[model samples]
Target: MEMDVVAASELQRGGWDVVVIGSGFGSLFFLHSYLKRHPDHRILVLEWGASHSRQWQVDHQTNSAVDYQTTISNHGEKDWNFSIGLGGGTNCWQGMTARMHPHDFELKSRYGVGLDWPISYDDIAEYYDLAETVMNVAGAPDAGKVFPRSAPFPQQQHHLSRTERLIKADRPDTFFAAPQAKLTSNVGTRGACCNNGTCSLCPTGARFYAIEDMADIWEAPNLTICTGARVREIDFSGPIAKAVLFESEGREYRAEADLIVLGANGIHSPFILQQSGILGGDPGSYLGEKMLTFVEIMLDGMDHFDGGTATTGFELSYIDGEFRSRHGAVQYWTNNSFLWGGLRLDPPGRHRQVFPIGITVEDLLYKENAVVDTGNKYPVIEHSGFSDYAMKGLDFAISKIPEVFSSLPIESVELRRVLPTADHIHGSLRMGDDPTTSVVDSSQLHHHLRNLLVVGTSVFPTTSWAVPSLTCAAMSLKVGATI
Candidate 1:
């Protein structure tokens, strides 16, 4: 299993029903669904990083479960950390899951801003159901009118932290609900979530870590997973992606497959496609553009509340297109008063300190805004100009800060640093019916390459208030069904 391809004597050949490029949530979900539905199918999953849960080693250049001193990406010996391991980023993600609002699917037509998704919320609602079931999501029923669903949530939602309750009591206008990912009870093979506070690295393994979930599916006779396999390029015999080229233990190898899926996150997905020449005139043209990272504003202040996690509750009043509905919905994340609540405070004659309050809004970015350029094999971001409207929306988000946490007796609340924040990158290969404006179609089939499908958030036209894992999982389910 730990064969080095670059050092192999013969060009190895293996066949599979499907070969997945990355092991992120998108990849895991799709593979799970595929194996579940078509148990006869053969799945070969190649992860570039080492197997974190079962490995004694960890990567140094890039922080992966794999214990490697060098970086996995082609950009250089050091650059970004795209998890090439078994569980992918989910191994280290804060398990915050929410579905994209209906409007997010129709961003272009609704606001005349970006391109529209070929599919709509109606098309993928069931997949959301599947995601919730698998993750054992502890979210309340659909009290929010915006997310209209025919069926009640499978399980009851979670309870708000004590800090969240206080914040809501102070800011009645802002509603707070227990986030949906960490569970109040167990769903299936996954265990009940013990509020370890370290949900990002839930050592107890109770939280819905996708790697753990998928590992169970691997027990099925048809599925096979290879860790420490870093995919360098997606090989295509014409438009159809024939094989995925990857490296393991200082050597390169290729896994030929009938179908291929790219679940690499926003940063690395485009990097792989560009390296493979998929962006030239057809799918490639729209491959690396139309990028959207939610504009995140981190405001800090002092509060007496317990310093726990930063994000606990959220407000959707801004999302239904209310006060600034015309501008689109804004999301709010609550910080632990001691932690997030005090990130901005000038400590009592204090030394410097920083806390990440977790509340966030899903604001839009200009489509033609930026590109990921690898210079000297190092990822260099070339950001485009921010639209005036985007700036105004950001300002609006800032102006309404006091409405959420009035208790934070702020000595002085100042902007820390406005930056692009997205756990999931989207829109490089947007989905649409036409080839001119998009890269993939409703089925996630690339517009130009009929047989090639680009999975994950790369198909999103705009960022949404919801975390993308659920949405991306739902979309991949739909894609797998068609394939």
Candidate 2:
């Protein structure tokens, strides 16, 4: 049955089997995985934005969403509501897909800074393989062995651009293979990437957005996708989530289900939890804290040497305990190269016409400063500390850019401002073995509500260097199978 878009107040209690909030890759993966495993279970997903088509571009960009309110962080309307329409962030993502390493799961025990995950790398290795297969990553293997390995990526990394090749030869150690969601060959229902490099607003779905991948599941008999809807909170009676309150088209609706999956992104998921008044009153609370994102900055004067995949490979030289990179996670993509992705900073004067190579650092959000309810629709994120780490990583990466491009003037290298956005933001309503500390369990079940579960980066305890979409999808699959 097709998902019916309704207002938050009008929804009949107990109307759904599983009610999923959010349309990003997290929700898409969970919905796909659920319907794949249990055909009889009815799954309803709610997205705040429109369908993933060119008409939905909020900023006239191809695949980007254009119709939402602008915020302080990302410049345009593309930075709309945290959770919108069918694809979620996957709709606007640059498609740099990779799995979180084993070490990432144990950052707290090994590094003694953050908390260790309830699960480990061994638990999700195969799922990474499965995720890559699903995403259809194109690239050659990391010959230098930078990222942890389990199986060969479904497709080798995409070919580097001519400028990228030159930079690699000029500084072989500085550059790595670019992993992307675009296919080199037909995988599942998608085709090869057209290499327009206009992937951000891919006019065509060839780039493998999760929504496009889930098109089949949308057609499936068991799953229903409800778009143009916004989930306000999970309605709980005592400890059990009996329904969800949401609004759409200036109206209200409620949905009740045996199982409720919260796939809202890292920010909004916690906003919903706190707003529901289910999990509150814990300042030192492990739940709704410790969110992570790769803090990225664009070097101002670095030559725009090239373009292609948004992310090449990353370096782990900073991963070891002795590395003075920072207490939180930090990995540098080869953004110093021209057009190869070091400049993602949108300067105040250059928003309409310039693109910079952006250097992204997997900055860990310290438990000290993370998302907390400020009694608003969104969580108040303390970003001062993480901002500092991002600057440090940008400095480190910029210092080496000239080594790869001697033609580019070193002194002319202008370090521009940083962008406060993240494609991999995870960790809000984290899952754990205990409800006292976590909002959900290992099975993705809500701690207080037996029926309510969340599957997304929000459930992650520690943010890893790899993109969270694949891991989030993997966990969602595990959860969906149970339903």
Candidate 3:
């Protein structure tokens, strides 16, 4: 491998410039930008999961060699889904890549709901374009006009279904093509979307896998990658971080670095920080998201799965409104999978009946809903439930959903059961201008330890209805370039 990977035992103490925990989107994107600025800097990446190749995943029909449930001990009713392998969440993420609305940054200031992010949309807009280009994001040509993109998506969006075309004809601006990393057109070694209905382990490498596109960053000679290494804690003294203590292959090892970057997702990152007793603030708190699913019965026999990708439509008709003040705003994603997400078997003869939609609601952080450290790789989920704001948002969205499609075909909408988990974890280490209310700063730097940075969605100040991977990647690029 060109990326100079090594075993954890090969790690030397106090000899690295930067030590990045986890080899997911956040870590790789940061390294991609950071290495461009400081080419000769020695880097070390420690991943908790096995290094399974793309072909291995396809053949095995699973993302990781490590079973996610076995990795985390969940005592609560909520289930948090994430991959614990070389590519991290990138191996298992649905390809949706929507940006946070411009107003999302100033939720507290503008909408009087949720906390405002320390950074503004203008501050990271360019980085969003950069992240999209790197991932070869296929999206609507007119996508993100309200969010206000400086540049268009790298690839044109896939063809919408016939029914969706009619829906767009009514209000083209409300519903835009889903911004996704799945290639609509081929790019170098990456192939176009085969639309085979299986995306997590795409058969033709259509979906954006960090391993395929970011191999250069992984194989860089200065960078050393160590898989099957789970970071347990950060070793810091007063105001400076010294090293990371991790477990690998039944043995505990210490890897020291001048700077430490914790990108181990919302749950694990906070667990490590809390265990270390870092001076910034509480690392593991407010860990929950609102998730619900619904099925729309197309009375006129309209086809639903004709879109090019799994999730082809984003229901923007209900999101980003004045309703966010009292209750949270919801993100509705049209599930375009006839085989998996959008099928009604019970109502036999009528095959093309459901226009399946998945809903994600924004929730204010609750201290009670948290992860407690059990000194194991698995975190104890103390999540009670979604906030009343989130529940209210769901109620409002469910009520308005029928009206959204009211202009289209006549059908009976069946509100499905509320999902136990959205699988997208948020708010373990919040970022803000004030250290009193946050764990990291707008720059993603630790207030107490300047040499330490908490990257990824874990540092999110407020959870938005948007999928966090895109914004997380943008934040990685922004802070990665500067540091």
Candidate 4:
């Protein structure tokens, strides 16, 4: 079946059974699962930007053309780094996929800090398996029971680069092969990983991009994807969502649906809710509050950049422990690519010897650090400074790196606090048991509007010290089962 790409102007009014607001991992996986159960139902997906194929990305030398606005806050100016095309950020992701540690869900109980997630790891563990299989995850067999997987990975782990091997050989307990969404063997139409370090722009379609992974569903007769459709407002009457009003090519259009699912990114999801005037009373008070992201610290070391997947190894030993009571949980990983382009080191071989290691610190959610509409076309980010706990975790993680890599004969180690570029934004429109403190319930439905479901990391109550794509995918699949 060929996927129909229709213009917003062409869509007939008031016929859709379900309307998905974004084409990212969350929306794509929701469509994939929902269509499997409700195959003949009328489904429509509205994407804000144009679709780009792998070939198109290669030819254009860019993954997305959507203009994402910068987030301004006390933390200073920063790019949200979200792609707004058919596949959304999956098109530009580095492919690292790991489940949030079980402890991440029960933060309040264990650490006496942060809010507990309404759902636990046990509730969504199977969904994680389903998502990993769909993404063709390649992970270490020896990853142990740290994340508590019921089944092994779908494919064998990718071979570690020489640098990764050295680090693992020295600290086997601390270092393990990082689980990634890229394939290790041929899987249906998708090809195997070709060891091309540039996963952000994978030419072989080996890495899992939502557009490629859900190609079959996108091509299904039941689904219709509308590109360049900028959803301006979600019109509602009482508790029911009536229609979605959007703009395309300078013309306004409306498409009605029985149910609406908002899978837009964290920033945009809340922004849309606010714009639509369906965010309950005091929208800004809780809807866009408590924005969270990982704080990264870079460590430069010697003889380490042996190119492979960008992130081939990670240290999970520090993910949780007594340290959590005082500071945030920490996780570190080695970067396989020497991406410092155009900068010529004074000495020739120094560039090859410099490897970047990143330490991720869990950010505490604060009401002051938030996303506000402020009458701007895009949301204004009023980010707060890092908590004392996060800073302590960063300092602790930096000090431990030298000991963990002591056997590598590292020559020079430089520690610098890099800007928040992990792109794992969370906590806007968070889900909680209380309606006053949260925007959505455990089922990810809007507390006020029962028909509206908001999937993705935006519903996360806390930020864990891991990549959030896999967890977001799992959450989408779980929501699909309910609907």
Task: Give the alpha-carbon lDDT of every model.
Answer: 0.58, 0.59, 0.81, 0.77
Q: Which candidate number has the best TM-score?
A: 3
Off by over 4 Å in 3: 12-14, 339-342, 345-349, 374-378
List, residue by residue over 1-483, the lDDT tens digit for candidate 2: 233444444444457878888777666776666777678877777776667553356255545453433311321211213435567777777677655666777766776655678887667666666677777767557633655567787776656644456556664653566566777666655656655556666654557676556556767766566666777888888867888888777888788887787777676677677778876422213322211223223334543424445454444444434332353344455432334334334555432122234444555544544556666554555444343544554566556555534533333444554544554565566666756667777777776677777777777776555566677877766666565
Instruction: Give lDDT tens digits, candidate 1, residues 1-483.
Output: 332222222433567778777777777777667776788877776666655552222123233644322442332211223345666777666666766678777766776654567788999988888777777666656444556566666556555555456655775554645446665666555556555465665544556666555555656666666766666788886767887887767877777888788876655666677777777323322222211222222324322223223245666555545333345356665433332223333445332223234334444544443335553342333333334444565566667766655554434444544443344555666677876766677888776666566787777766665667788877787666657
The per-residue C-alpha lDDT of model 3 at residue 92 equals 86
Ranking of all predicted structures according to lDDT, beginning with the best and ending with the worst: 3, 4, 2, 1
In model 3, the Cα lDDT at residue 418 comes to: 78
Candidate 1 vs candidate 3: the TM-score winner is 3
Off by over 4 Å in 4: 70-77, 281-302, 341-351
lDDT of 3 at 157: 93
Which lDDT value does model 4 have at 427?
81
Tens-digit per-residue lDDT, 1-483, candidate 4: 257989987886667999999888788777767888898889899999888887788777788876565432223344456788988888888898978888899999988988899999999999999999888899987786588888889988877767678778887776888899988788877788776577888878889877767778888888888999888789998888888888899999888888899988887777788888876622333222111222222324445545456677788878888678888888877766644332226466555655567677886776766778777676777664567777787778777767777656566566644554567767888888888888888998888888888888888888888888999899889888877
Deviation (Å) of 187 in candidate 2 = 5.7
Question: Relative to the unseen true structure, what is the C-alpha lDDT of residue 383 in candidate 4, on a scale of 0 to 100?
Answer: 61
**Highest-lDDT candidate:** 3
Candidate 3 to truth, TM = 0.96
Whichever of 1 and 4 has more lDDT, that candidate is 4
The candidate with the higher TM-score, 2 or 4, is: 4
